[model samples]
Target: MHTDPDFSSRGRRLLCGTLAASVLPASLAPAAASAAAGNWPQKPLRLIVGFPPGSSPDMLARAVAEPLGQALGQPVIVDNKVGAAGSIGVASVARATDGYTIGLTGNGPLTTAKALTPSTPYDVARDLRPISLVATSPFVLAGSMAMPAADLRGFLEFAKAQGDKLSYGSIGPGSGSHLAMELLKTHTGIRAVHVPFPGFPQVATALMGKQIDLSFMIPSIAVPQAKNGRLRLYGVSTAAAFPGSGDVPPIQSALDRQRFDVASWNAVFGPASLPAPVAERLSQEIARILQTSEVKQRLLEQGWLAAGSAPGVLAHKIAEDTAMWGGVIRLTGARAE
Candidate 1:
């Protein structure tokens, strides 16, 4: 009976050892294969845009998607998840479980949205990882050519004179247009009612129709209208005149010793905890893509300057812009429509 019990104990121990050996190797097999292959982005990649179709960010994302798809040897899809000042798309990207998901972000959701809406679901710093900054452009302070404000100084004086009666249009609350206008209002102490539009085209149309008195717009979209006498270029929202539009002077130059600056930018971001190797690879490919002559010409033609910044550089920029816009929002008491 003692021999039988001892033999049974040995058999149980052997079975347990065999199970551990089988399970351990199986559990680590995927990790080992991943390490050996370095096969990041093994699946199709999704680039999420916070705006609807035909928007600036959406356009850029589409432009880059095909080339990036070729670079990664995987199909890249642009997913437009528009809403809540782009927070909806951004939050979707943040919550995505796949490593192949990235967000095409702009000033709205990335920097100014949180400041305008404190209840933002994802932390820009904690939930998203910066991939690269694609481009930058200065905002153009434009108005109806019919208005008396020919320049920035005259515009401010006109705004002050109009006082509570003055109204301006923005794409939406927490948009770059809104923040730029709010910053101008805060700096100049001019009070104007904010009229929110669904998108830039609507805002531009409203300006053309004289539905809105004044608004800040991007040079690519607004300058042509100004040239066609549909709208007048009052000033640019940069310290110096933008490179492409020599006729439009800087807002600071027109305002006596008062400084105002506002610009728009686009960047790529991936979900938090994206593998470092994957991020680095994507950054390198983006930098290369931006360096292409065709890409440069296209961006310049659109009134944008190619940024081509690395991942770390873009991370720093996001941090800096977030803090800067937070103060602007607080000071202006800006809010959503």
Candidate 2:
């Protein structure tokens, strides 16, 4: 439930995980041309996930693989290649020349990694092409229950009052949680000490234990704590009230004059040379998949809102978010360790 679902790749054993592909439809022809007479996906397609099994990206990859394969008239196999904050797996996808291999990952490797680690092997804009966005969820600004702040405004006043003593936690430097908090600080003209933790679990523990003052956390992880009265949710980082989030207003509602929006998004991407026909058809198929009631319900139950967009739309998102986070990284003076 961390901002980057692929964060599981950090400090973990490397296991090449795989999801067994579903059997192709009996009516479907074995020829790749069955789908649309394309010279692609001549055999089983490889869908590479940068994170290990059960991570957010892996889950997304698994959920979409069967349908995407069926639509493309091939078996979509998920191959987990985990390491280096998901950069290793992404780099592999970038180097893959065949259209048969694609990547399903989140912000960590795609958007945030470049600003944090400029020396990363592959450049996102130059190497990979955007296919479509799968789903998204806003991060909640949460406070410990022990704190006196009752809402976003009160928390802001409290943070302003504390000044140098106010402290917050994030998964690590340059993560979405870290950068989002920094962006909030810049917008609101407030400052707080930052305490970097290894992951969301630790950050939640520290907050519940009253070791930290506040943090930006994903709704799935923060909701349970709030439900049990261990955490007090203040604001969600979005333009409007997020669905399934308990009556929490957008962060802009607190600031009045300012607006802020950030979310963890899972998307599909392939090497830059992926043919337009393939990318366009894949986007259309994914959009259809997302519209299905079953898939929508499953993603919502997991604290995600299913969203699909054209390839150019996703490309715009990637560019915009990359620039936005790059500014935050510079403002916070955060760099990869």
Candidate 3:
């Protein structure tokens, strides 16, 4: 899953000129001259989304693209390269020679995919530059109302009783839903089979068709179905109840103690070699856009919490989650087919 060990070495070399300028004397620095002449984003930029159109990542990508394009003064096109649990598109962005190419990634491909697919081509730490985190959506355990589970406790009991017969669907093999379910199974000692779909719609459809026992779905997709009596929500994956979903109880209340809280987050990322100035500019502009009342309202309507953090904070988050998921993956022994 890790890329060449020398990747960081080459990245360090590429950044050496910029790194030296800060320490060298003004009169003697060729680095400073080169940095001064470097104008980033002189052409159209491609924002690659690993998920298909209408997915959470795709929606957020479209939401931020206009403002990002305005700030960079270049077109920010969102290209959908959906496949391989998002590794297909992500690897494409990683291999692109153009600096303008970036990826709109989520928790799946950025962190969990590594553990799932050992031969994955891209390395998040070495290949991608972290930009601001756009938004976060918590997961919810949802089931068809025809089932006996009424809450998290009831769901666990029912799952235990069903044993190998019960099953759950997730976005893909290494998705947040799959990890959360794995953790739940480990904690509860339930033995539901893992069923993975290509995307959310298919999972939702399977639930509606009574083809699957349950699923961990995003609020935007699950909430509407729950309201229409198509799906019955058991509990949220978060430790506490979310803002809009008052009717749905938090999983913590049903279980004696909660062990997992997973959130599906979307963030903007570019090539690691992108200039610091350009990264800062993009971060600032995104922060401004998220701060606006209109944008905030739109995001709220979609069950997303606006998170406009600095580039450094975003990078730190990616690193922290990578380590966190590594432990979970090791514990569950989860892998892609």
In terms of TM-score, the best-performing candidate is 2
Ranking by TM-score: 2, 1, 3
Model 1, position 229, has a per-residue lDDT of 84
Instruction: List the candidate 2 regions with Cα displacement exceeding 4 Å.
Output: 1-39
Q: Kindly provide the TM-score of model 2 when superposed on the true structure, using C-alpha atoms.
A: 0.88
Report clash pairs, candidate 2. none
- Report the error of model 3 at residue 117, Å: 1.9
Model 2: per-residue Cα lDDT over 205-319, one tens digit each: 9999999988999888998899998999999998878886889989988887776988989998876555556667888999999999988888887788889998778867776
- Model 3 residue 238 CA deviation (Å) reads 2.1
lDDT of 2 at 223: 87
TM values, all candidates: 0.82, 0.88, 0.80
Q: Give a tens-digit lDDT track for model 1, residues 156-206.
A: 788788878877888876778887888787678779888998777898998
Q: Give the TM-score of candidate 1.
A: 0.82
**lDDT of the candidates, in the order given:** 0.75, 0.79, 0.75
Model 2 lDDT, full chain set: 0.79
